[model samples]
Every structure is written in structure tokens, then in C-alpha cells.
Target: MLAELKELFATWIAAVAAAVEAVMDRLASRRRVVLQEIDGDSFTARLGSVAKGAGLRPVSFRLTPHGRPEPPLSPQWRAALRSSVVEVQMRPDQVLFREVDFPKQAADFLDGMVRAQIDRLTPWAAGEAVYGLSPPQPGPHDRIVLMLAATARAKIQPLVDLAAGLGAASISGVVTVPADETAGTTIRLFNTRLAQAGRLAISIPRLLRGLLIGGGVAAAASFAVSAYLGARLDTELQDVQQRLNQRRAALRLNQGTSSAELLLTQRKRSSASSVMVLEALSRALPDSTYTTELRIEGDKMQVVGLTQDAPSLIRLLEQSPQFTRATFFAPTTRAAEDPGERFHIEAHITPYFGSGS
Candidate 1:
């Protein structure tokens, strides 16, 4: 059981190593090509370029089997052919011919050529016409060596349409190089190995131009929005602050007015209290005793007098309703000639009454 597990582990390791090596080889290899091919019934219309060390070798070829007859060429076929670079490579049992042809000015002849190429390529190149062209370079004419992958018209056309829709100035040529360095390049290799053989280098100039235009518009919009919002916020903040200041100032003025009113009300109350105290004293004094001096100090009243009779005055004060618990100062008798005695007295007067209390 341990040996079996070891063998399985070894196999997995070998597979992993092989995959890593394959990826490294692809990255390091310099072999590449670009091709555009439209196959015919008896011949294939191909447009391609071989990438040399630095330059390009333009090539076009039509591969045909022996004993097979050549198809007639038409105007549309000629138009397609006008843009080709051809080369012939003969096989042991097959004849390979490559040529550029121009259809006669007549419409019928052009139509015939188009039909002929279409019929010939039907078995090998089915469905819609396939276009695969390569990036241009100079290289060997013996046979176009290819990377292992090929280009697909279905894939390449959308890219072409995309470039056209965006109003691209030009579309880069398609590549049909083989991923295998040893196998000679062919239509089949271009179909199968283009993803490996091809390099997709975008147009730096076009991209930069788009970015500059788009970026400027975006930046301007952002700045305008920021400035507008900032100004609006500033204005709102100022309005709120102004309102707060006004409210604060108004509050201070109101408080000062309220304080003055309170002071005036207190003074009026004190004056009324004085007037009432004097009135009460006048009403309560006895007939035998007339106050000679009346002094008011805060809430206390003092009375000094010379009465016709001191006993009568004392009795009158004690009986009065206004004075509470009166005390008489020491009385001073007059000289033998004088008529009456003098006395000083002090009394506390109630300032105001609440509920008869």
C-alpha cells in the first residue's frame, strides 16, 4: 500500500513539472506570426507574415491535392486576392500553387471566381469566411514556421468590429503562427495555435488619447461639483450663525429690561408701605397725645412728644392698635414753672398685613 501511494505521488510530481516547463517555454520562445486566411474550394486564399529576428517576410500560399482540378476565379475572389502575398511549396504527391489574380472587368467573371473559391474551400473551411492575418515581420521563405496555436475568424472578427465601432484609426493585423517551433506553419496550425503564437499589443497612442479626453471631462465635473457644494454649505453655515447671534443679543436685551422693571416694582412697593404706616399711626394715636416728632427707620417708627399728661400718653399708646408692646424712655420733668413733662418712646410698626395676620 505504501509503494502504491509513493508511485501515485511521483506521477503527480512529474505532471506538475511538465506543466511548469511548458509554461516557461512559451514565455521564453520568440517564434511568432500573423495570418489571415480565406479558404477556397480548390485553393485557399491566405494573407500572412513571418516574424524573423526583427523584420517580416510577407507570404501567401494555396495548398491543393494532386488529381484535383483548379476552380475558376471571379471578381470578388480577385478583390480578396488583390491584398495577398503568395508563395508556392510543392509536395511529393501534391501541387501547391500561390498566385495573385485580377478578375476581368465583367461582373459575371468576378461572380464566378468568388463561387469557385467558395466551393473549393467548403470541405476544409466551412461556415462563414475565415479571416486570420498576422503581425508583419521578415523571416525565412522556406516555410512559415508557426507557434502551436491558430487564429479564429469568429474571435478575430469581433475584435475587428470592436475596433471599427470605436472608430479606431486602424486594426492591428491578425497572427496565425504555430505554437510548435518545429512544425511548418499551415492554415491548420493557424486555426489551432494562434493563441500561443499571437501577441496582442494594443495601440498605446489611441489609448492615451482616449484617456486624456475622458479624464479631462471627469476631472472638470468633479471640481465643479465640489465647488458648488462647498459654496452652498458655507452660505448655509453663515446664515445659521447669523441667526444665532441675533437671538443671543435679543436675549441679553430682554434680561436687562426685565431687571429694570423688577427694580421699579420693588421701589413702588416700599413707598406704598411707608405711606400706609404713617396713615395707620395717625388713625391710632390718642387725642390726649399728639406726636411732636415722628421718625421712620426701615420698618421701625420712633415717637417723641410733650403731652399734656404723660400717663394719658402712655395709656393711649398701649391701647393703640398700630403699636405693638411699646416701651417708654425715662421721662424728664419740666422746671417748676414748666407746664408738662417730656418723654421719648420707641415702637415697632407692622409694615403690611397679609390675610389679616
Candidate 2:
């Protein structure tokens, strides 16, 4: 049993090492083509190394924009470009460069800090742009300054798709500074890898559309279920309202003498109901203010309250459509015994149901 277990472990170890070797080989052996965009749409293609800083070969092959067959590709050139990593270099004019200074503590979170400010720094949101940053260097006042390079994704996506159509293994997008700079600065904006660039671009949109369609279906189903359950409750409420209207109609028919009834109706119209006055006060008072006592008589309402700012309550009540002519009935006072000032406020209650009197 021990010998069998040992053999199994050896097999697993071998498999793991083989996987690592495969990944390293893929990284080391991948050939790169740097497409130097010229004349706004055309590119000068040159072969480059996967090794860092080896740079592109000096020999140049100019390729025209799509939809033109000015120079046909030889089978050898087609084979060379097939399944190679393509690097699309944007001209300095195509990119927007901005210098930003951040506190030294933000070094580790530079990506997030820059992303949050992308909208402020450029015309596009973070998600809508392909962007990169220079290495942070010492700046004034214990800060670090980093150069941000960005361009609209829409502007470069067509170029990416063009490379992918040529059977690229992966695609990398970059932008460089003008030759006048002391040192050439190249910032990589985006990368799509794993010899799947072509299929990936098509699949991403399909995936996003599928997710949206599924979410909409789920929301509709939930709404239907809730509406089904609430139908009976809505019917019951309608029935209750109908019975109330019938009862009021019968009471009006039974009331004696039209003149006497008209007098009572006039009094009712002028009266300030406690419920309405309380609701009005509740709506008028600030969240920090609370009343200890409330009184409603005829068209007047008086509220005795404790508040952080007692004087502001008068203006608040006066501004409300439910009350008018609001003022202080008594002095607002502060005492050591209480946490807030005690206030006596009076406002005339408007009898208009939905309209200000």
C-alpha cells in the first residue's frame, strides 16, 4: 500500500511540473508583431521579441487599412502573423495624457484611486476607456506623481477586432510619448490573451446580453407572483370603501331639517380635527423636534415642544401648506434640567383638505 501511495504522489508531482513547463513555454515562445499605426488608419508592421526590452526588428512591412487590397499578403507573411501576439501602438495624438499627484500612502491603491477619478480627468468613464499609468515618482509635499494615458475604447476596439480576424493568439494595446521626451514612455492599455482573442470578443457581448435577459425574466416573474397574492386584498379594500359610502348616504337621508343640517355642516367645515392637526404638526416639525403636548381648538393649533433650534420651527410651520400665520405664542427658554430648549408655538390650521386655505 505504501509503494502504491508513493507512485501516485510521484505521478501527481510530474503532472504539476509538466503544467508549469507548458505555461512557461507559452510565455517564452510567443512571437510578437508591433503594428505602428500611421496616417491615422494604416500601420507599419514589424516583428518583435517576447523578451522584455528586446524591441522590434528594424525591417518594416507597411500594411494598408481594411477594405483595400493594395498589396496582397504573401502566404509566408500570412503564416507569420497567424496566431502571433499583436501589439497595436496608438499615436501620441490619439491618447490623452494627464499628470496626477497622490499621497504616498495611496501607492498600493493607485489603480482604484485613478479609476474613481477617470470621469473627472477625461470625457469617458473608467469602463469606457483603455488606460494605463506611469510608475509613481517622488513629487512635492510628500506626494507621488504618475502620468495617466487614456483613450476611448471605441477608438481602438476596431483595430483589436482587425488583428483578431487575422488569427492573433493575443492582442495588446499601447500608447507612447513623443520622441522629444528625454526617455521614451510606453504605457500598455489593454491585453487579451490565451490564443482566444477572436472568440473572446464575440462571447463577451453574448454573455452580457444573456445575463440581462435572465435578470429581466426573474424580475417579471417576481412581480407577477406578488400581484397574484395582492389581488384579493385589493378587492377587499374596494368592497370596504363601497360599504362606507352607502352608510354615509343613508345617514344623510335620515338627518332632520335641511336648514339644521346645513348649520351643522358649516360648523364641521370650520372645526380643526385632532387627527388632521396632529398630522399637520408631524409633517411641519423637524426630525430633531418632538412635542410634549398638543392642543387643537376650532381653526387654531398649539404645539409645546423641545427642539435643538426652536426659532426655526416657526418658519417651517408657516411654509407648510397645512398651516398658516405661524408664530411663537410664548418665549423659547433653555434650562439646565433639559437637554433642548422648550418652545410654545401656535399656527392656524387650514381647513382645505388638499389645497392651502
Candidate 3:
């Protein structure tokens, strides 16, 4: 159970970090616009300098939430259209887009759907963005598109409302250029202007045109995947917590278990015995050798010091009643930091039997 909790914590942390990184990536670029669906087959977008000269092309695809690409869309999704759609003309190195529209009801439905998806996107983003949609047609299969980030919505809303308030015709949909097409253009732009930092992620749609095309199986798969991932995450978290707790328990076991009163009684006796052993070992050491570092684990002692002769040090340790076996782990050596030789030795002290450790 403890192990599972720890794993859950780790996964949550990782997911949050991923979410933050994605948001930061967007904010790190100079593009701060997004496309949003307005009402049936109508949408709006903020075209930055890159798309200022580009044109739109017709394509079919599905729109999905960030991170979770498999979330289910409403069955009525097929009848919906983007609120903002645009018609573009491209030639040579120049491009231009003109907005278009669809039925009001369809456009509104699509706008709501897009909004819901953005709201649910994880690792929530701050600031506003715009989302533009493309005009779609009734096809033999369902179609979906990648919508813009919700963060971009806030930034674009005022302009959109202002345009609408001015009695301008509703915008018909927008499109995003594929990253592959933009390849390195952004990089060059950034290098040329080091002060520029904003997001430029494209929001291309992944349309699944046609209704009833794998409708049942695809829906089932989404449910299955969500359930499986949720369950697996829970199980993993439990396992990790359990392991951590077990490790903690094992470490505590090394101290041995006893009642509080008994533990206190044993500690006093153990302390005196340790002091006596150290004093006895110190007195027996050779006059020419000095103890530098001493460590005791159980009945084993590791002594590090320097001596005129290694053999003489061994003999002196052997003369102590508390010590039994003496071994040299490393030969005496001179250190660069200090102009003196150092020796490392190991020995086992005979614990007085029947006395509490």
C-alpha cells in the first residue's frame, strides 16, 4: 500500500512536469495567437508573422484534447462544424486566407465542443489563446481537427468580440501549417531576434471523416484504455508504497525491538562497554602510532592512523584484550594534502557474552 502511494506521487509529479513544460514551450516562442471555433462551420484565429503570407488547404481530421488523444467525442459530433473556418489562396511565396461560415447551430455546437476539450486539457495553461477551425464537409467518414490551446483563447477573445461588435461577417474557420512545413523557420527567426520568445505550436486537425466508421470499436477502445491506464496507475502506486514501507521496516529491524524501558536499560550498559573498549584499545596502541579515525559497527572496528612500522602496529593491536582478529585493509600511505603517512586497519572486538549489545 505504501509502495503504491509513492508510485502515485511520482507519476503525478511527472505528469504535472510534462504539462508545465508544454505550456512553457508555447510561451517561450513569439507566437501568442490561437484559433477558436465561433459558431457552425465558423472559427477565428490569430495569424502571426509566419502565417501572414500562407494559404489554407482543405483536409479531413479529428480534433482532440492535449495529451489525451483518445477521449470520446459526442455522437452528435459528426453534424457539428467549426465556428471559425478560412479559405486561403497560395502562390509562389505568398498566401492569403478569407473566412467562411456554416449553419449557426452547427457552428455553435462545434464551438462549445472545442471549448470543453480545451478546458479539460491537463497541466492547465495561463493566459489566453485563440482557436481557429476549418470549414469541414459531410464525408463518408467522421473528421476531427487539432484545435488551438485554451491559453491562446484569452488573448484572442477581445479582438474577436470587437470584430463581431463592429458588425463584421462571422469568420469561417482557420488552419495551422504542419510543423514539418515550417521546419527550422522558427529557429532562424529566434536566432535573428534573441529577445523573441513565444509559442508557435501548430494546431492541425486529425480528422476522422465519416460517421459509424469504427464507431463502436473506437469508442470501446477509448473506454478500455482509460480504464486500464487508471487501474494500472493505481496498482503501480500501491506497489511502490509497499516496497518503501518494507525497506523502512527492514532498516528499523536492525535496531532490534524491545519495550521502551528495556531499551533504555540496555543503552546505558552498551555505552559504558563501548567506552571501556575504546579506552583499552587506545592504551595498547604503539607509542609511535596514533589513532586517526575509528568506526565501530556491531563488534567490528575499523581504525585508520599512521605508524613508523606496520608490523609494530599490528602487534600492539593484538595485545589488547578487547581485540581478536587484526587485518590491514590498506597499507600505510602518504597523502598529498598532509605530509604524513596514513594506515587503515580492521579488527573484531570480542563482545562480553550475555551483556546486552
Model 2, span 23-117: residue lDDT tens: 75466666678778775656767677646324433333444444221355455555666777778887888788888989999999998799999
Candidate 3, superposed: residue stretches over 4 Å from native: 1-260, 263-273, 335-340, 353-357
Q: After superposition, how far is residue 155 of candidate 2 from its true place, in Å?
A: 1.5
Weakest 10 consecutive residues of candidate 3 by summed lDDT: 187-196
Candidate 2 minimal-lDDT segment of 10 residues: 61-70
Model 3, total clashes: 75
lDDT of 3 by residue, 1-357 (tens): 999987775565545544654565455442222334443223343343346324432222222322111233222321121221222111212111222233444543765565455434423332233333444434333443322312244323433343233222222223343444432111100000011111111111111212234686799999999999999999999999999999999877755665576687776545435676677677878677777898888778888887667667777777776777888888778767744568888888765523444
lDDT for model 1 comes to 0.45
Off by over 4 Å in 2: 1-28, 49-72, 179-182, 194-357
Comparison by lDDT, 2 against 3, better one: 2
Which has the higher lDDT value, candidate number 1 or candidate number 3?
3
- lDDT (Cα atoms) of all candidates against the true structure: 0.45, 0.75, 0.46
RMSD of each: 24.0, 29.1, 27.3
Per-model TM against the reference: 0.24, 0.44, 0.24
